[model samples]
Target: MTEVFDAIVMYQRDHKEKDLMVKMLTRQAGKRMFYVRYGKSKRYQFAAEMQPLSMSTFEGVINTTGLSFINDVKATRPTSFLMTDIVLNAYMTYIMGLIDAAFVDNQPITKWYDLVAEAVTKMEKGLDPQGIANYFEVQLLPVFGIQPTWGQCVICGRRDLPLDFSEKLNGTLCQQHWDTDPYRMHIDNRAVRILSKLAEIDLHLLGSLNLQDKTKQEMARLMDKLYDDQVGIHLRAKSFIQQLTGWQNRMINRQSSAKEDES
Candidate 1:
């Protein structure tokens, strides 16, 4: 039996010769993998719409006992600009990988699909790629029930405390808590405020906001640690981003400086 659905291509792998294996995050059925023959032929080369972040329509059979095969695929919007720019491509790849890792098969996360679609559209229209990525991470956490406590102290529940997002407490920690625990990751009030604002804004408006370099760097670190701790590892695309953004180079320089200082 064949069924039709709207889907976003999450990842694709070339199989033997002309075959392709595609992982799609569908609006109706969630994450699913499908096999397609002649997927690489000139006539169907546009079917490379199966590449990461392409939104499309799919018609296929759900193989109850074996690998599923898709009979028809039509690209709705290729989101092709995600591939044209280096920074946008890396951000989209990381977010797509996050969705692929977190959601289960056939379980609908309609809101997430919409958020991703919107983010891609914004990027295509010339939005600040880094800010959009930070916004996506903030909004995504709440949807997954992994929201970091930022409005108040995660440890003491003190609403009046100074803002300091500490990973040790898993949220914004008050000064008292920070003073008591020397191991906590100290995030300043500016960073905490930016995170709080990012969580509250509509995804479409993410492009309109301006974020300081320091805040963006801090938020990136916070998000990287959060995903690594929750998802058990970082996405390779994210590491690619750190390299492009000079994050890895800075760390190496800092380590070298520290070694020289010790000597």
Candidate 2:
């Protein structure tokens, strides 16, 4: 049966010599695969709408156990920036990969669908992609069977003290209990606060990230360690994001040195 639904185009690949296989996360039908034929037909004409990270409305047959087919399509959101910006594309790829990792195929998760749709829309509107991605990563932890204690200290259950993240403790450590874990990550307190905020943030209401560079760096380190220790899944897209960040940092350093030399 043909059904109408909104979806995010996750990724696509060549199916055969003359067709493409498109994978989309549909709001109503979950993740479904559709075949976009390469011919002068309406399906082929709308094939461009299947670009990665783009949101579109689809009229298609959604099957539970096999490949579905697309009948018609139209863009549901403005994603010109996602198509043109390489960095945004990288973030998009990583975000899509993350969703795939967190859930299985053909599983209808409307809440997660809404969250991911809002996140991509935010990114297209020029919000910080890394910040949005970070929020998603934190939210996905529970799906990986990790429930970090971000609300209160794991040991003393205190909420009034400054907190530090302890991978060994698998949660936050209050100032009074910091000595309990010798390996507690002594990151910027701001990082811990941001993680707490991210844990409860609504993606629909989240604003632009206004974090200090040091705080962002510290948060990244802490999150990386946390994921490595607890959730061991790795995606190549994440490594690409790291490489992009490395290049950005190096370019910033080069420009700073050039300015200092001129001064």
TM-score of each: 0.80, 0.94
Question: Model 2, which residues run further than 4 Å from truth?
Answer: 39-43
Pick the TM-score winner: 2
Q: Summing lDDT over every window of 10 consecutive residues in candidate 1, give the lowest-scoring window.
A: 62-71
Supply candidate 1's per-residue lDDT for 27. 74
Mind giving the per-residue lDDT tens digits that candidate 1 earns over 1-263? 88887888888889999888888777776777878788877788546666777888777786544567677765477666777777888898888877876677767787888888888888777776777777777777755668678767787888676777766666788777777667665665776777777777778566565667777777777777777776465679888998888974688789999999999
Name the top lDDT candidate: 2
Q: Candidate 2 lDDT, tens digit per residue, 1-263? A: 88888998888888667788888888987788887777234546775687788788878788878888888874467787878988888888888888889899999989989998888778867787877778888999999999999968999899888999988888999999999999889978888988888998898988777777778788788878877778997788889988988999999999999999999
RMSD after CA superposition, every candidate: 5.3, 1.9
Model 1 stretches with alpha carbons more than 4 Å out: 62-66, 73-75, 139-147, 155-162, 175-177, 200-207, 229-231, 247-263
